[model samples]
Target: MANPAGEAARPTILRTPLGRVRGSGSAKSGTHHWWMQRVTSIALLPLTIWFIVALATSAGMTHAEAVAWIGHPFNAVLLLALIGLTFHHAAAGLQVVLEDYAKPEWVKITSVLAVKAVCTLLALAAALAVIRLAV
Candidate 1:
């Protein structure tokens, strides 16, 4: 109803003090994403070092010797972990980049999806290759 000598009153929806203060609050996923990124980065460090060392030491090995090296249980497991962590870390980083730099809404979403899909496919391929070698 219109107020006397004024425009109609606006309706008010009730909201808690916290909700008013914080707006809609966080998306609730930022912390989890941040933690995952950090964890993957930490995991990648040692795995990267091990990979470098393995590559360097294996440089002169014959093809059969290299395959045999990967067939070792410890090496196989570490290689798998390295593959997974590396791709995860890369995807996380790319996600952040796309979120920050991709302009249009569609572009950002598409970029993120593409990055995730590519990373997942690459990780799976690497894991399968390693498993094939190990077995």
Candidate 2:
């Protein structure tokens, strides 16, 4: 039906009593998570390219030569950034997937927390390794 102003009336969504009690609900953090995912993805592009080029250029290097390449200040910093962002992106993606598909609430929460912890530890280890190499 058209309203007095001639715009069609919008249909209203019918909710169950329980749903009505719950109201329009959300954790209110989806936007932040989405933005972080996008920002990390953009940051990874250049870092990944740098890694590929560096790897290709160092293809035939001996252990010492490779170590020297990584030990360069710029390379070390970029590598650390790459490692950190890669792990963070993985964790965020995994979290979304688990939240969407995991059936039990406790399972979903536990899986997300486990992913976060593992990613954090891996990133820390990679960063430490890079720092040791640089030093």
Enumerate clash totals for all models, in the order shown: 0, 0
lDDT of each: 0.91, 0.91
lDDT of candidate 1 over 1-135, digit per residue (tens): 888988979878666788878898656886898899999999889999989988987678888898888888899999999999999999999999999999899999999999999999999998998899988
Per-residue error (Å), model 2, residue 38: 0.4
Estimate, for each residue in 1-135, the C-alpha lDDT of model 2 and write its tens digit. Answer: 788899988878665668778786655785998999999999999999989987887678998988888799999999999999999999999999999999799999999999999999999999998899999
**TM-scores, one per candidate:** 0.77, 0.76
Ten contiguous residues with the weakest lDDT in model 2: 21-30
Which segments of model 1 are wrong by more than 4 Å?
1-28
